[model samples]
Target: MTAATQTPMLAARNLSCVRGTQTLFTDLSLQLDAGQWLYLQGENGAGKTSLLRILAGLALPAAGSVHWQAQPISNQRSEYHADMLYLGHHASLKEDLTLTENLRSLIAMDGLKVSDAAIQDALTRMGLAKRQHLPARVLSAGQKRRGLLVRLLLRPAKLWLLDEPFNALDANAIVDLQECLKAHLKDGGMIVLTSHQTPDLGSDTAGFVLSLSRGRA
Candidate 1:
């Protein structure tokens, strides 16, 4: 089926979150279907990261609930997680492992098996082929970011939830990532990400920012 006719991949109903007596957001709700994109805009302490964690099934919301494909994410966590990719600001990469090893380890957790040539090709495209054998701890900040991004290329899951993905990326890398995101959307993949800096996703792209402070899109 085409993305336009498919059910929403993610849905949150009357969600609320409070951290240490501080209400980050309350009575918030949103839905994301296939082939759509969501950009989160908020300042520090506005709960952008917190909300992303909640949606990604990593944190519990203070109130309300989220569903994946009409099933509560908590109940269908395995299925939900299998079809999603959550990229945090600091991706949990093993510092001692080389970039290639890290990518293989992470992908394997999702029950995916990829060939070495394919993985090497993806690293090469990220401009990391030469450094793939080096430990992630020794890589530069931008190189580490690029290494984590390789997960996106290897596993084109249905839902992509990225937190501060543009941080530490250079101008050219940023542009390349934007094009990659556009291609994913065109393939009926959905994405929800936060970026402090504005992104130019080409003139034909369809996207809108979901400002967290007001819980408005």
Candidate 2:
């Protein structure tokens, strides 16, 4: 008998993007399976962020489709979103809300129920224990980014779509996030992230890189 092939957790086929008159990319395809990471690399205006947005269902592709579990994402928006987490380049936090409150709101918006204690723990892990109760308006850029990253631990998602997750992070925070990514991959999660700088996932980790400059996978 022939061996059984595993279905990818996330897949994009022949995706094309256009912003006004400029064509960012075309015929782009990629697959991400459990325990794997796809690092997207390209220069500015290369559509790395656009492609990530398309995968997250925040925007549609000009051509082709994105699939989750081999099913077109358009057919199962709720389920797909529940299992995927997308953090864009910005902090996207409400300045009026405390860091803890912002995180709780995001969790509630996602329709996932996590305990207050769990949320606190995630924040603590992100090194925001002391500042968790402070309003986001007063936190530094790095603090806001760290607070946003707390969702990684609290979310029950299997796929992560992050754009420049390392931005504004200090050296220690970057290492902490790298550890978090490694831990997620260890547990059979999939990740697709765009970063201008190459991510250090250790010397032995298995992953792939797709450059938007090539215009296709």
What lDDT score belongs to each candidate, Candidate 1 first? 0.86, 0.89
lDDT by residue (54-119, candidate 2, tens digit) is: 999999999999989999999999999889999998898999999889988888988778899998
User: Stretches of candidate 1 above 4 Å error?
Assistant: 1-6, 214-217
Model 1 lDDT per residue over 1-217, tens place: 1134345678888889888878889988888886778888888888889989999999999999998998999998888888889999885789999999999988888788999899999999999999999999999999999999988999968999999889999988998899899999888888889889877776666676778774332
* Count of clashing residue pairs in every prediction: 0, 0
Model 2: worst 10 consecutive residues (lDDT sum): 1-10
Score every model by TM-score.
0.93, 0.95
Query: Against the correct fold, how does model 2 do in TM-score?
Result: 0.95
| Residue 102 Cα positional deviation in candidate 2, in Å, after optimal superposition | 0.7
Quote the positional error of residue 63 for candidate 1 in Å: 0.8
In candidate 1, which residue pairs get closer than 3 Å at backbone N, Cα or C atoms, i.e. clash? none
Can you give the lDDT of residue 197 in candidate 1?
86
